[model samples]
Target: MSKRLIVVFFLLLLLQPYPFVWSAEQVSALSKQPIKTVVTDRFETGVVLTKKVLLPNGDLYWMKRLEFTSDHREPYTFSIPLSGSNGTFRYVERLPAGNRWATIPVDTKLPQPSGFLQTNQMSMLLNASNFYIKNVQGTFEQQPNPLPINVIRTLDGYKIHVHFPQKKNSIAEIWGLESKESLVDWSSTPDLEAIWLAIDLQEHSKWSWDGYYVRSPQTYTPYSPNMFWRLPANYAAHSFIITGGSRAADDLGWVMLDTILPNQNREGYWETLPRSEWLWKDYGIGAGFFDTRFNTDIATLLLKGYRRYGDRHFYQAAEKYSYYLLAHIDHHHYTNYGESEGWLPADYSWKQPHKKTHVSLNHHLHEMNFLYEMYLETKQEFYKEMADKLLYGVKNTKSMWIKPNHDLHYAYLPNGKMGLQDYPFLTYNDLVESQSLFVKIYGRMDPDLAELMANKKQWMDQTGVKGYRFFPL
Candidate 1:
């Protein structure tokens, strides 16, 4: 035969389902008998076949143990009032509750299966999925149940009814179903595909609401809808526009360029706003806070915009933000910094005047890393010079947060003090953040320092010191 003819012959054979036919008399005989039950009970019990032994190394251990086994089964089906096309009675939901976005209630009732079947077969095929009998003769069987049984294929799975010659209201279970439910092919249904597309389009359309871009409607608060602007909402917006192709890029990017960035300060720093409609303030509840965390994030966003659009304005904006943060380094009035020595205040400005004197090792590492990023971006000697000074200040100052063994002091007060009582114990978070920067900075600037940081990272990983723990040596 030709290769094409041979291929067609095999394809036809593959499409055919296995034939398991029986005579009318045989069917009637099987129908009268109960489909044997298949039960799969799962428990945490394990067999300790051997006794515990004490080792020479002062360790107690079990010799041999047998773990529990599990069998996937068709869960028990409760007879509910199913809707029927022929019958007048039907099922309906009296109450509907839940978010439409998460779940939608189907008000229309579905018609019940036309027929039911009881089976004695080891395995049964229904709706292209398989159902297998898990137990036979009161013992769980690894193989499927034997043939000569009645079975009905339904939307959920094959429903097997039980029958006893002399007993009524008898229950027989068939567990360990190979297939439990029908899998819907959404792409095969044009209407469902269209609905899915509409939902996706609608979701993307609502990315930006009111004036600023938002992650979700759940994050939306009338008083401060733009609060996430300080967080990662702006970055998410920029990323959405950049990665989401022409439609998102044209609409959202245009709004960002024309409306959003222009409304902010000339130095390119966004002020904290108490209300969505309120004007930006310099020194009140939400004002004049140059945080390294916030500025660095915004600057990175602007830098991404510059790289994508080849817009000089974005670069200038990013540079201006870095400069603004750099200017507030000492912040002499509120911060307790001498002429030659100073720590990077966590927050500096009108709102957190008192906290300006409170130095944090974590925040200090963040600022230093931000400065280094700025240096890399602009290649400005001034930024590199500031980075050098920060490196020196963190290491040499009276509030040296890192120790010789690479253990980190959580935070430092203005009095150059840090430990568990006043500050916090070293955490995995603190170690990773500070050590990451240290490795990065030292790798580029000083190899010796980098080696030390590498050792610290190794020690931390090996020791398994996590949570709020003493500085792991």
Candidate 2:
């Protein structure tokens, strides 16, 4: 062969895609074993895996991971033993993307006795001076109290150790053990034990919504050059809109936004700014207008708030925004696509050639459903008509349903591809949302279609993605 021809051949070979290869030993082990062990210590109880199975495509995967707990009731630890003789395998910890695990010190020493006194209960005792106590234990023959002292539990019952704050002169006193049975008699106890337990847990639980820590410099932020008023105002707006007055959600959202928004506004939106030196200057202008997403969220919040509180002001605001969205629908594609047919460009930038094409079917469906509900509330013919058209367009659009495989149903790509072999990969969130939209629309229109969608949603739910927007009503 000529030297030039040989060089061209080498170039061609380099350009070709490399096929995935598996070792013969690995394949044989995977086929014969049909099981692999996975151990997870996420929950209070640890999980154990014991079996691995080979897929039809020869991909090795796990079949079942049996869970054997050390403590059956509480489940603190679990263990699993595999029987099959498989070759040496490497263990991989599946940490969430972009997050790193850090090792922290563990305190193993037992707490001191004086530190075990309950502060809140002690305060109440100090204030009252006269309180009835139930003594389940028979250890103390003579009851020491101002008025009433009742004992009900064994002396050596399971003792709970508690730590008290350090003080100059803090006194610790031991009371008779209170039996769980004594809590059944409400007349004698006045306060329900379950209610008190819940209250105690609420006071002590580590699960709290104190807000996001703003010190993390790597987080995303929406604004730059912190203006004190702007930060708090933006935080309040985001909190109220996203959380719907839930104090915890509101606080967390606010804190997270505070930390991330500054960096996000400066760095994140730099590409989308009008006077940017970036290759795509027009991209910035398009992004500035993309604030419509926030408007959409605000409209939703207003509508929900109005529904909950019957506030006419909120209703009026929602009505105005709903009309604005309805007015923007392209009437030309109404027959083919529906009210939302040609709305929302395929890409973030409006200048792109793929801009006007269909993007997220799920987002389109959600917009349709939202408009439909608004139509119902206002009895607007335009809103109603748009909702109906969008629903019809979505159902009939073959491009919207890309059958990637026999088991997989994917959203359409810009080039009408079936696989994720295109830009802007479809996610589980998109699929679930689309399914939910279909369920919502069909449930009201056709019960059979609704049922089928619901089953599909259940299957999606089993994939381990929780808090899916769609749940059976």
Candidate 3:
């Protein structure tokens, strides 16, 4: 071959993807076989691999190694979502030796005493554990954090660069535990838990922490910065503490309430933000428009916090927000089309009702749930009456049903049009809670709500456990 041709061939060979596998003496806790490394597939951006290990006991376990073989011109921003059995999955990180395993027992009201190490130590595990990684191996380092790391920015933002570097053929690993036998009910929806868990991991992944929240950098892709302040995030919280709760969840939930109480405005509200609909843009009102959605959401979560921790402060804060929700309705009905009477706006102004604004489906659901809870707590028929009115609006005015997928509409606009589909699990969760409240209050399920829940469940099963959004190339 010509020398020039030989040089070109060498470049092509070097750029081509290479897969790596390593066998470790590490025994799988479950399969009890020597843990084996498995390489999966390669995408345009990076290669993906599943490093399977025996779960300490013979239970099923999957270890995933995320890394790359190409040199990026700049720091690479990486995010790959997984679709799991629309059921129960636990994301447990392997810790260093002498600090291997500890668990928060299910249903324990108090946090487990931290004798071994805090769950946060799992972060350290990413930097140090390399049993699953390929080209780049890691040494198990203990608590004081022995690895010297750097920080760099990708398209996502600046992160604690584990030096999970953008070097040729580097690897980093993160472990996740999936349980299909436990029969988690949402059998087919995307495994958002695993998706979110991947943020902290750096199987050649970047750990970006913006200045705003040291621990919480821009973890999500830009378009999907889903409702940092616009809507309720109960589902995100759900992913955090399922069944057997954790110390992290307990602490985070408590701190959230504590922070909100002091920061709430005198009118029993936080600074209002806009709504999201089409393509992650604020198609609703701009900022400073106080949406009733926020009040209802805060109130509902506070009520939950009160129930969980018996905090009077939580109840007090929730009650204030509850009052705010009822008081802020847009009585003028500018976009009034369907059962417009007693319906709320997508957002409202403190000075006057937000006329000409759109109607929100999530508002109806959240407001209904919040008001019903108020009635239960305070024994006020007024709360039930308002909640019933909102329920009536949904049942009579809106055609939220998506028969094939069983999804609900996102927003009801002035032109009698509904645009966008509700997040796969959000509305379903709302309907279930609302139905339970309806049953508790009136001793019977609301027929419409029951149907909605049933349909939502079906949709969830069909969609299964896969991340909803795909980052555009």
Candidate 4:
């Protein structure tokens, strides 16, 4: 193949579902009978798993240990082998209702599988010939349960349908899954992993409410119909957009941008391409809508997209945001509740009187990093200078927020105190990455920043970013 043709072929191949096909026997072995965690009416549950592990640098192993359950007793005895133990399987969230993100132990007896899989994901081994993924959350309430799959109700002594959790990242997990319930058995998996892949790498040509267009306003979120609930802004907020640098992510972002840009209010601070857009219906819930941090992140990604796609608007968006940050380089009123500091706003948003809140270590550092990237891309010294000034805020305030064990308090509270809680050790990862970015920018790292990074990493090594869902670290 010629180079150009080879490149095309490579992308086409990449678009295919995870290339592991199970044999007739492989399918039969798992489906004919259930591979379960229950024993004589008791359960031997494992930890709930996610597509990505919070801890860095380790491999994800598959589990016979389906740990998400109410029962806390020891194994009554499991249906599958539980060997090669590494971690302990501790509970991250202990809420009575049990609505939380759970964690895996430092070491456990988990079997390494043929390819990537999560304890939460259905192995394609389950016979789901009936139901379909109705919406983003894989809700199946409206669909008919003709397959007798998940049809067992109260009279049947069933409390909740027992099945594996299926939160696939790529649509790759369900390529050949078109079986019927009669020939197959059931429909339990949500099987909704199309959030990243643009329906097999094909473009939507135009955005529509009917199709997947990179999540936003999900029917009940803010700026969505009525703010019925905030719909998890922390992880879901910038993640889709932050997934922007690569060609595939850019493809998804185009659809997402189309959804957002068309209806945005765009009447906030930063007035530059970097300015915040006011998309709320109430008119004035949050002024400026946090253009400083959120828009800065968006602008940097836009810069990346512009460079690769060579679009003028991309450059314009980032250009405005970068200038906004620079224009307010001396935001004295917005700093540490009193003293003049160059930190970016993380917890709250406003620009007129400059709404101030506790300084978020992650937000400040992230903005600093974004500024440095903007400098590198546009060859501007001012962005770097601003980033340098922002770095000083972290160093001076480190002792105030960082615990002696190196775990970070989530933010510098407005009451002139450090928060009691930490982010399960996420700040450590931020500190480590920030040092690398600065090192690349200045050809060396700051001594104070370097020391902080070292201590944070040591802390991470000792405890793999363990955090609870309801309560923070």
- Alpha-carbon runs more than 4 Å astray in model 1: 1-260, 275-288, 332-343, 351-355, 397-407, 419-473
TM-score of 2: 0.37
Clashes of 3: 22
C-alpha lDDT values of all predictions: 0.38, 0.32, 0.46, 0.39
- For candidate 1, which ten residues in a row score worst on lDDT? 123-132
Query: Every model's Cα RMSD, please?
Result: 28.3, 27.0, 22.5, 18.5
Off by over 4 Å in 3: 1-244, 272-284, 291-295, 330-344, 347-355, 398-406, 457-473
Q: What is the per-residue lDDT of model 3 for residues 1-473, given as tens digits with 9 covering 90 to 100?
A: 12453344345335633111212321121123223346688855477676553332232334445566676655443332222211111334445542222344212121211111112112111222332122111111111212333333334322333223445555544333322232122234446334344333222222111000111114222222211222222333333333214333343344345435754667777653332232123333334345566566666777777656555667777766665565554242322234434454444444433335566666678878888887787665566776776777677654444455576666676566776667767776677777777778888777777676676677777779443322110
lDDT of 2 at 216: 11
- Residue 352, model 1: lDDT of 45
Q: Write the per-residue lDDT of candidate 4 for residues 1-473, one digit (tens) a residue.
A: 12453344245335633223445564553333211122222233433321211111121212222333343332222222112222222122325874232434323222111111112212111211121222333111111222121212233122112223322211111111111111111132222122322221111111222122222334222223211111111222244455433222333343333223322224312322112233233223232244444555556656655544444455555555554455444443244322335453444444444435556677677677777887777554556666766787776666676578876667676566777565555565566657777778778767767666666666666886544111111
| Alpha-carbon RMSD, candidate 2 | 27.0
- Tens digit of per-residue lDDT, candidate 2, span 117-179: 111111000011111111121110111222221112223321222221222121112211111
**Compared to the true structure, candidate 3 yields what TM-score?**
0.48
Q: Clash number for every model?
A: 11, 24, 22, 15
Residue 433 of model 1 has an lDDT of: 44
Instruction: Please name the candidate that would achieve the greatest lDDT relative to the true structure.
Output: 3
Model 4 residue 442 distance off true place after TM-score fit, in angstroms = 1.0
Return whichever of 2 and 4 wins on lDDT.
4
